[model samples]
Target: MTTASEPRTSTGVPLPPAATDQPPAPPGPAAPPQGPPAGTAAGTAPGTAPLRALLGYARPHRAVLLGTLLVVLVASASGLVQPLVAQHVLATLGSGGSVVGPIVLLGVLVVLGAGLTGLQSWWQQRTSERVVRQVRRDLVFRLIRLRVPELDSRPPGDLIARVTSDSTLLQSAATEGLVLVANGALSVVGAVVLMGVVNLELLAVTLGVMVVVGVVIMLVLPRIREAVARGQQSVGAVGAALDRTLGAARTVKANGAELRETGTAGDAIESSYQAGLLAARYVAMVKILSGVSIQAAFLSVLGVGGALVASGHLTAPALIAFLLYVFYLASPIGSLIAGAGMLQQGLGAVGRIEQVKQMAVEEDVDDASPVAVRTHSTAPAVEFDDVQFSYAGRAQALRGVTYTVGGGTQTALVGLSGAGKTTMFALLQRFYEPTAGQIRIGGVDIATLPRSEVRRRIAYVEQESPVMAGTIEDNLRYSSIGATDEDIAEALRVTRLDALIERLPDGLRTQVGTRGVQLSGGERQRLAIARALLRKPEVLLLDEATAQLDARNEQALRDAVDQAGRRCTVILIAHRLSTVTAADQIVVLEHGRVRALGTHQELVDNDELYRELAASQMLVGEDGDPVEDLAPVS
Candidate 1:
């Protein structure tokens, strides 16, 4: 429910042009807050505990990860010995002794290291895939179970981006990203220790250069994380733009708004690109610094070691091994830099994924906790005890609305659009809770019962009559999956859809196009009614069920409702006053308040609002006859 004063968009006779044929433009979807996006429910801000959450995703795969890391460790250790072995070969040559033993050992180390590295690569990737799969599955499960209000508050496209794009980021960041950082640190430490053993003066020169460069790079990495977060949000906005436009594709086309929508989506795309460039700028700087750090250290070591060897403090072979170690240090520095960047990006992704995880989801209520709902059939007389409700950030939709609907009777709610008509049904279904007041069903307060339990006893068909993408049988069986074929036929008969189904070549198996675009407006309305009837609910609430039907089908539907009313509570909302004249009770609402309550004739005689509505439809006039004998207009 949007606003009490806003009328529903209606399709009727063309209005007299206000200077031209153009009609006043309808409103658009309300924009959600841009900060952190509206999709995330209440939780800690984006930066909190992202690293811990990333570690948690890989915790279950630690054993496999440990095994893979051991293989890489062996490979790295063998590579570390290559330079030392070369020094031995050089010494043996200088002594004029056999070098066969040293040469064979070097060849063996090379083969072993290569083999282990290959095996580790494959094993680590397999584990990474498993981690990604679990994260995606968990996200999907939690997203589907989120409470109604959370879903109502967010854009679906943005939420979907978390499951898809964010999880993909986690794929490497949680697994290989950690491996890179750990292995790089170990390799760097090993190379530094050997460099110290070979020559302390050279090691001092290398350490000084490394420490300064490391500090500079650390400061810039966090900026990458911030840029990535902004980029993810822009991408989500792009998705939202496309989703909004595609949902109303026909409306956009009818208004010739292709260019306008194209610009909207293009703008979002441009924002994403700009954000990507910022992150890229930071990332490129880190890579350049990593390379520069190694080159600077090598130059200092070369200059220092040359003087040491010339002064007879360092041997020629030792200087060569020390130089080899400095060059070997390059690989570890590069990996360390890459790993840190990946971790920062992963943390950014985790921020989005964690927001999804924190969003509140509906929990199943215990059937026998503090209150027990009766399983046996009872007249579910609905009573609204001064019900007052309001949407978030909006004025009251229903204000102190109170009424009692007798069980097993036909009651109609008559009001102009947004007079709290649809809101009444939403409250009954527990889609949104009432702000103040109580709703009782069968002398028991409904709030004490579980939402699923409350909904099980009632069925509702909305005015638009939305349809799903599937065959007729699939949609009919959506609410009651266990319903039998015979039950479906009976429901179709009641809503006067049996004949239409029979006319189709596929009968019950006929495919309904997306949102049931394959069916006419009247046919879709009837199909929704049929689907609701199959539930055999204790209470049936229809919102303009007959609005799209022809005279004959509308009368047939009313007859079916009249029959069902004898066995169950039937309440309906109707803008056309003629259809509700035969109702056992009529509640007239105006501006979120009940204006009058009585039989249709009584209201016509006494209530000005009800009388005006009736007169507008020509249902009653100065000397108009009673409405019961007249056929209802669809």
Candidate 2:
């Protein structure tokens, strides 16, 4: 919603980072072990219910995840079988029985468990890739569909970060975290149960040690979740910084601000580094707790089991089996801790991703009937009926502006900067909604029509003449996908781009580098005009279309436009009095209001502002001499 009168930065600031070095954004609430869908559980966006958001992603891939979980369970069961087989081998040897059968069974179980572990690895990795892909796709769709106002509200860099870095965090969380929590819990239960059957005295001592560590772990987990959330926020900040700096690269270099700009990005990068350290610190704490719990329990069980064996309370094979179960118990506990950490990290990303999803997108009706094309005729082809409008949180850009242009005629808007001329074009294009009043095309209210339907009948060339990254032909057919080669040549010939196209080695296929930097300003302007003309729209809106052209090219384009004006309604905003002097009608805008409505000759005679602008452009003076013959005015 930035107007020509205001610098774009004046209208809106870039989105701020949620966390900084000094004060971090607090982590969201702890996630449920079995989270629900992101939007359903909280009836809100993803970040607030991050666990649910994660589950929502996994939900779509539930069959794959369940498959992965099953493999993990089978692998854990294979592992659990090893300790029992080893105990049998010991018992057989002690009984002086044939030990070969037990020994061979133990070796076979070891190989099967290894093979399942490898299979589980493949499943987890594959499932993680799929989850990340879906997350990125969802983010990309939301980003592209975001309304202009939403785009204006945030930096493009931070939005991109959601697709890149943030989505990556969700990959493992959806798959690995699921396997760890589910299989680990089951494995831990199975190991504890088997250990209890072998010796209750050893099991009791081990459980007591684990309870102390578990309580301590619960107390510290919330901090890890908070740290991870802040870390991801800082990474987003880094992206925002780079985007801002790189977008204005020329300006930064022109101002000799390379160091300063780099420092700005560096500051964000440093913040991310600090956050990374904080997250790692919390993760290390969890690992230490998990590792310490195992060691403590092992030592306590070993000492107690040894004493029991001495007292004949526990047999040798039973103590050996109980101890083996204690060591096996460590693997699942570590998995649970790792899974919890990954879930915390994924939850951190949910808030930023959800923030983007919450923004409103432009509504387009897919089933609405296409608007009928209007042919040449004398009627009010376009009308602004007491139209009132304003930018978000800004003063009115248009104030009860009322006017009408006849079909098959050209109407020019002549105004000083900030007089609402461009804003009129924006309103016509449905980029913004009017606060009050109606704008009609061919006597039909545009508001009642779908935005896409309305745009299909009108062609607009903006003042900036933006060119996207692509080949020349690619940009030409962008608006009208069905435009033929003959239509392209005709449009180019009209805008005087045909000669340039012919001179190029690649002709129409020439590459226009990023933002069309490979082309001159006038060439880009002509290219924009040609693209619009190719649409052959019912109504054409041009904003300073000839601003960059030399007199000869401008005159050629003017004649071309004049010829086309015979078959369609054309509304153009121009600061150059010469561009609109011969128009069928001219609307004078001043301070968001229509100050005058007349032909250029009529205005020069009747309105002082019109006369001044005409004189400034050397189109007219009091004596009305040709521009070159005119004497200098004080």
Candidate 3:
């Protein structure tokens, strides 16, 4: 193994000193702060900003929302008529008149109220679903378009939570919260007015009690919003933890670390449970407070109204009607408080969702029109001029390095593992931009072009030969959707994968399983090569493409490389020197700079580092073992 102190490649290039003191940063996006922002703190109410933003999401469905509001009003009116009908019945009985007509009217009002309530509920639910669906769709679109750096910082599970759970909160808040709050406020106002007409003293007493209770609820409301926000964050943490474990399920199982993984996931799950408990505690407090306020108001009304009735200041029927209105106040008051709570929860979710929306997103590209490859080119196809790059929390990976690879020629890049070989490939594909300097493709500065256009002309096959979970044919056609069956067959034949297909029971339809576990390493590598070939790109990048192949498969890969070189510029990185001996040119890199550039024969004769590599393998002894060391070059 290469150690930090004495980093050396097979080609004898020395690596930079390692900063082993600091642990390397994990790959992917930078992680955000552990907690929500200060604006989402526990003391803060679900403010106008969140509510206003939420309304923006609901704007598209405003027409439906308006209709639902009308339905709610009709329902509220039906509910109000029942109490008056009861009052009429009580008055008729007191006057010694027939009560049958008033009693029948009361029953009819009850039926009408029930029917209207159900219809209102149906419309409200439908509107909520539509709003949620649209919110989720918009979130998804923004998530996918986020810039690479932003994406790297966020966990996949947390993002999924935003799309699923966070959006669900908006559903309840948009329809139920808005509609209930509206109808409840209207009913409360109506009740207050009717109660005043019956008895002003009783109405004043009830309002006084409600005012005190409302103040208490307002104090507790902000706390509920805070707890709910934390709960949702905890839920996101659970999702992120599960995603981490499942994505590497095989590795955990193989290492017998299942218990450890489960423990880690359990911690996240426990956290979510605790947060939920906190939110529930606050919600319960709100419910108890609302109930107590209503009970207190009822007792006060009954005591005061009874004295007035006995004193003959109020009639028995008016007292009864006033008591009914006092009871009516309970429904709307409870509903209003509940709706407020739901709105607070949704506002918390909105904060999280809005954070994602505010992140930087990549510019849209016109994939319909790609940069056309030059049919006739005498100039170099790829060039790097004084390029430099540094990844986060690390020393520079590439120094001021410059080189040119001619069109339709095979150039092999040989370097130490940390000598920026992979970094070079990344720059070529514009997966990252150089911190300094320029890169040109086909005599055009790639910086001036869209990422999509730059990538359109090049085909890159990574060293790992990653395969998606799909059938053989699906993986093959991934890069080239328009590729014909004959085109696929030709690529398979060139990469010598035709025989594997013939032997499989399902031929091209054979499933590769997850990450192509069903295929051997060599087969996966060749499959990647075949996929790239089908693109017919102007430039082909093979990063240790034949690393897993045996001697026979390696030879077949060499043939494929030669054939590919005839039509496109081929640049490959390889550790095995023998495989690249026939390359048109070899560029050796050391410490992120070009150490030597020449053909196999020329480098072996003159370059000491090249000679050492050749002696390690090709320059064998008479006993068929490699020589220990060759004489130093003069």
Best by lDDT: 1
lDDT of 2 by residue, 1-634 (tens): 3333221221233321131101112111111111123212223644447677778889977887788888888888888988888889899889989988888888887888788889889988988898899888877876786655456555566668778887888788888987898888889998888887787778899999999999988777767666766666666666766776676677779999888867766776777788788878878888998999999998998899889889988889988888888899889998988887787777777756766665656557332433325443443489999998766555677889999998889999988877888778877877667778889998888888877788878888887799989999999988777778898989888888888988999998899998898999999999998888877778888888999998889988898889778767899988877777789999998988999999987888888898888888777865544467753232
Report lDDT (CA) for all predictions: 0.79, 0.77, 0.77
- Against the true structure, candidate 3 reaches a TM-score of 0.87
lDDT of 1 by residue, 51-152 (tens): 878899999999988888788788988989999999999999999999999999999999999999999999889998999999999988878866555665
lDDT of candidate 3 over 1-634, digit per residue (tens):
1112121122122222242111123322222223346224222344777778877877888887778777777767767777777888888888899989888887787787778788888888898988999899988887886655455445678878889988998799888888778888888988888788778999999999989988998888777677767777767776777777677678778999788767766776777688778878888888888888888899998999899999999888888888888788888888898888888888888877776766656564444644335444432478889887665545777778898899999999986677778778877876556778788888788878877777778889998899999999999988887788999999999999999999999999999998899999999999999999888888899998998988888888899989989988999987788778899999888777788899987877667777666666655333334444753111
- 10 residues in a row with least lDDT, candidate 1: 15-24
- Better structure of 1 and 2 per lDDT: 1
Over 4 Å off in model 3, which ranges? Answer: 1-48, 98-101, 366-380, 601-634
What are the RMSDs of all candidates, in order?
6.4, 6.8, 6.9
The TM-scores of all predictions, comma-separated, are: 0.90, 0.89, 0.87
lDDT of 2 at 574: 86
Q: What shift in Å separates residue 256 of candidate 3 from its native position after superposition?
A: 1.0
